[model samples]
Target chain A: MIQRRPDWLAGYGLLSPAIIIMAVMMVTPLLAMVALSFWTQQGFELDRSFTLANYFALVEPSSEPTYWMGIPFPLTYPVPAILLIKSLAMSLAITLAVIALAYPMAYFLAFHVRGQKALWLVLLTIPFWTSYLLRVFAWKIMLGFNGAINSGLKSLGILTEPLSFLLYNPLAVMITLIHAWVAFAVLPIFVSLDKIDRSYLEAATDLGDSRLRRFLQVTLPLSAPGTIGAALLVFIPTVGDYVTPTLVGGPSGTMIGNLIQELFLKQNNAPLGAAVSITMMVTIAAIVTLFLWLIGFRRLRSRAR
Target chain B: MQRIKFIDRMASGRIDRRTMLRQAGAFGVGLLVLPRLPQAAEVLTCLEWAGYDSPDYFKSYTAKHGGAPNFSIFSGEEDALAKVLAGFKADVMHPCNYSVNRFVNAKVAAEIDTTKLSNWKDVFPALQMASGVVMDGKVVMAPADWGNSSIAYRTDLVDPEYAKNESWSIFYDDKYAGKVCMLDNEIAITIGMMVGGEKYETAAVATGEKLAAAAKEWGTKVVKNSRFLWNDPSELQQALASGEVVAAYAWNDVYRNLKRENIPVAYAKPKEGYFTWFCGLTMLNTGKADPALAYDFIDAWLSPDTGKQLIEGSGYGHANMKSFEISDKQAITDMGITDPAEHMKQGTLLIQVSDAVQTEWNKAWGDLKALKQ
Candidate 1:
């Protein structure tokens, strides 16, 4: 008689591929990055001596600390911290806008649509069909000086000289991001809304809840996980984005991600870039954790149960 | 530099199985004709800038080697350096004067045996002995195409007085505020130094942190007043073409491209002078291809016929002195492609700064681009 297989063996066997991938793709690079952060760059060569210089440089108070839109930083190494703040602020604003815009379209699809739901879902994916870059380029053309909007307005005799302010600013960045990320937000929220049990609404109605009240107590509470997940899906990547900001975020739109790129590539200071990257990642993690804690994630999950 | 992006799109799109098979087929045909010379049978690989991969530049190489060098294209000099340092197995690479030193220091670049290149004597002596090209009495890079990094302005849009005496200070002018774009690189910081009345060609600007704070201040002023920092040469060209930006820190190609389109653009000859730029072929230390054939490819690029097409077709200044005799003289004069050493007296030839000094400038540049105020 054969002995039963070890319980953990098959479990690990099934997970082996994923585990190996995670180890190679994510864990190893992270460990290398962590190791790299401790070293210093001398020209192109890395001085492997372990030192805290890279970390300390972040708060070394060499030059004047920057004040971004009245938010004061009394101490820092002139670059990393402020960009982190700016990126966070921009990503948060984009997340909120995405959620506000996406939820309605998702709600309409999940509840009000009679048939051909796949068609509508496909329509939502049209923006994603091209590329993240092409979409940004389209927006650039539309908002440019002699761009679509300006030319259109000029042809209609609305004004003269074109609106130079339409593109290459924080507002332009926000508009592009909100449009680019809305599709990502919509699908998750739509799934959550679609999965909501109608019987709960019926029960609430029988209990004398109004349509609006039933939505607030039953529907809204159920969709909280998806909404938050969608927010995170958009928020995490956008925070570290360099392309969108660099393209449209003119000088004022310069963010921490661009700084990190400058360090790694142009400055050829991999160690400093690594340190700044780690700091930015930690800062984002802290913000996300605090946000989850503030939202009472455990309670929200348990309530959905 | 501005001429590169279009070629990048083509190279990335077409570096497929078909191109390789076709190139291999050509090499196979070449092997039979020169059965004794096995070096000609082995295919050479060149890492060229995006637009430089056109067949006309390497026609003679193909004729001699039985096939053209298989091309790997890079969009930026920094990218090319990183690839070579990572052991990407390219036999030849094109790096500019500003970056050729990095290759030499890394030991990934070999001293090109200029004697093998029959065309070497015809190359501009100034460029032949340019700072990075001759390091400790070795030809590190085979000089090729070059251009100037100067302001390309909308001739009709700018004030005539400012245009008459074109100055780098125009980037800091209040009248063109939020309407002029500056290059977002070390070039900008150098231009910033120029605007502050410092001579970048001298050691005072590069040796230490003596002018670091000044560089930072000028950077702040130029960046603060300008609309945005441009990454690609095309972005600057487009802004100039549309009249969205009145002036931009642009390459000679942008001015030519805009003028070709009847955009009324002018290449600026600032009072400070033109910042000259030249890029040439550097043989990689990788011995992936036969050494003799690699020199053939460099020689072909230096040929006057290729240089003519290089000047007329792509609109850049080819390095061969004889190339000027064949191309339209008016076009050459319009582009200011005269001897780079001569240009250096009026302005600075952008060479690699010393490592310590570079670190300082990089910091200043980082601050200039990263800082808001």
Candidate 2:
């Protein structure tokens, strides 16, 4: 006797177009970028000599002079090194701030809100429909000394003078990044939360687990993947972002990305810029790997139980 | 069951062979045609600083020419150079006088034909001959606009008495340290070199040791007190309006815009005189040559009408002699160039620093920034 065959191959044949597009558009550029990071330029010409100078420069700080008193101090610390440290600090701060603010909102949308999950999700994504540049500029205007927020506060007699600290500060950069990336942090967590089966919570309750215990065990562990994914999404882009820091970060808020721009655009130093880019990529990759490892470890432990 | 199996086998065998051949043929045709497709439009892109090619000005040029000239705006000369070196094919670029020599030495710009520019004679001869333009008897660039690197202060926020002094000392004064802003530009920082009694070429070629010492001392005095080191005029304007910064190093147009907006900001010609940057248009030898169109564009931009428009719109003093006559003298004076020739003499062109010296400047700037932390 013989049997009939499945028709899923036809569907896969249709998907080949999309698969080819991904390979060419996404994978090809990534491969090209990796190649470019290793390449160096000399004067008006690009040199094909494979060198680690670019990578070294990224990891090593600039050898520029450090001034002290009337004496000139030749400081070993390079700009790239400083930028790496600064970018990491700033990106981490932003990630933590987003997590702190977004987790609760995601929680509310997942558990507290009923029959309006889609509505709130759409609302969360509304800000993204506007131009990113315009959104950042809006923050600039709102935080301006005579801007709406300051003027509003003054009108309410809550402050004596318009706050000077509102704009051109690290605080402003943080605020803008948080607002810009809130949806990025929230959606993933929400999706994870929504996927949790209600019967599991009921089972936990039947097992005499308290609300906090149930959340810690079932909900938090289950949501770990989403939370980690959200962090990686936000942290990687924020660390290398130049516009946000330039527009709102002021002098104090300038980041490694700004220096990389200076190298690539201002200084006309391709090798140095590539070095900076590669350095950032490596650092971010290491951090992301560590995070994924932790997540995997937790998953394994959960599976073992 | 036998009939059903035989039918399934027939369908699978027929479809699989047909699909495989079709996919192979499609891939082969795509591979052949993709490389043959024509590239995007050829543009004589200009990498310029802001205010050089604002929409209002470019729109008129585009309207007359039937198309807009492509402009890739950059905030800093270093950034512009980096882009240029990284395979950006801009036919024309606007690097300041100081960096022109470097561009020329690096063979970035082609030797320009001065005779092609009809309004060449109308440019202020001194500015036209600024250090970056005529290198080794080759006219590299046509000077567009020249101005002093002076301070702009908010009269409404800063005491009139303090600002009335009209000296560079006010910027370094402890009284205004936390309320002062400086331009985050090499040219603006070079003013500190002048104030420290170093000449343009000397500062340009200053060793890492000298630069580090000067920058450290300058940094210690100013960085902490600096309310902001701004890249854009708009940022400076915001700082002035908010009282976060009472004074700042700025170009003339920034102050003009503030006054126009009723912000009461005033520009002063410091007693130490002001450092100047003269930007010029230079042609690049992109593999595809368009010398005629490039020359036509250059001449059109230098025409008295265009020059006058730039003066009126950008508030930067034009180098074109014909523009001085065509532009409103009172308006020109209001923009702070009372005597264009005298102002040109007072202002000095920025010179390009060699790699060795630039390393020093970078180090010093980094240390200065680090001091804040």
Candidate 2 chain B, run of 10 with poorest lDDT: B6-15
Q: Give model 2's docking category.
A: acceptable
Candidate of highest TM-score = 1
lDDT of 2 by residue, B1-373 (tens): 9546634554564346464456569879979878666775565577777767764434444655677678888776666666766677788878767777656766778998889888798887777766677888888988777666678887877777866577666666788866888876544445666677777667656666676666656655666667777767776777777677888888877877778788877787676676666777888775243566677667766777776777776677776788878887777776655445577566664556775566456546644654354
lDDT of 2 at A125: 90
Residue A267 accuracy (lDDT) in model 1: 71
Per-residue lDDT of candidate 1, residues A96-190 (tens digit): 99999999999999999979899999999999889899999899888988889999999999977899888878788888988999999999999
Q: Deviation in angstroms for A17 in model 1? A: 1.3
For candidate 2, write residues A82-148 as lDDT tens digits.
Answer: 6577778888999998988889999999999999878999999999999899999999889877788
Question: Model 1 in CAPRI terms: which quality?
Answer: acceptable
Candidate 1 has a DockQ of 0.25
- Over 4 Å off, model 1: A297-305, B1-56, B61-83, B86-90, B203-209, B286-293, B313-316, B329-347
For each candidate in turn, the interface RMSD (Å) is 14.0, 6.9
